[model samples]
Target: DAGVTQSPTHLIKTRGQHVTLRCSPISGHKSVSWYQQVLGQGPQFIFQYYEKEERGRGNFPDRFSARQFPNYSSELNVNALLLGDSALYLCASSTNSQGRYEQYFGPGTRLTVT
Candidate 1:
């Protein structure tokens, strides 16, 4: 099976701008998660959705939002982007069965805010 995929491998934007990043989960996965990773730091959880419903969210500001489609794909939107928003946006697909959960991540979308 193919892994998760993210669009616009790289993106550049100016401060105060907005961006929308897309992600396609792996086949048969019903859960999707979004994360942000700054240089030299681990990925920080942003949001998670299961069966198209939001399950969890991290400490990000209101400028961050996301939605999962019926097809299991997800999109992350950031408003009023700041230079600190520059980082790798990651998408992960996972499965939860009998209390066991496994997640697989995509290559990630690199965003740069100038």
Candidate 2:
């Protein structure tokens, strides 16, 4: 049983470019969530999807978005990238959407902006 996995372990981008990060959840899991962690700060929740429906969203701007697939995989898309967006983008997966289940996190996709 593998945990969550994220692609492109690292990314380099310019201020206005858009990027899409991918994630695959553990087998049998049905919920996937995204988070942004700036250096020296806690992870900020970006989005959570369960059963292919959006369950929650954080305070992030409209530039941030995500969706879960029928297979329980997910993608996080960030548009109009800014320097401030440079951070470790983490993907977490759980068994349910009630926030009560244990969540497994990925190694994270490190994003760097210039």
Which number leads on lDDT? 1
Instruction: Name the regions of candidate 2 deviating beyond 4 angstroms.
Output: 97-99
| Clashes by residue pair, model 2 | none
Q: lDDT (CA) for every model shown? A: 0.96, 0.93
Q: Write the per-residue lDDT of candidate 2 for residues 28-93, one digit (tens) a residue.
A: 888899999999999999999989999999999999989888888999999999999999999998
Query: 1-114, model 1: which lDDT tens digit per residue?
Result: 889999989999999999999999999999999999999999999999999999999999999999999999999999999999999999999986757777899999999999
Residue 30's lDDT within candidate 2 is: 88
Candidate with the greatest TM-score versus the true structure = 1
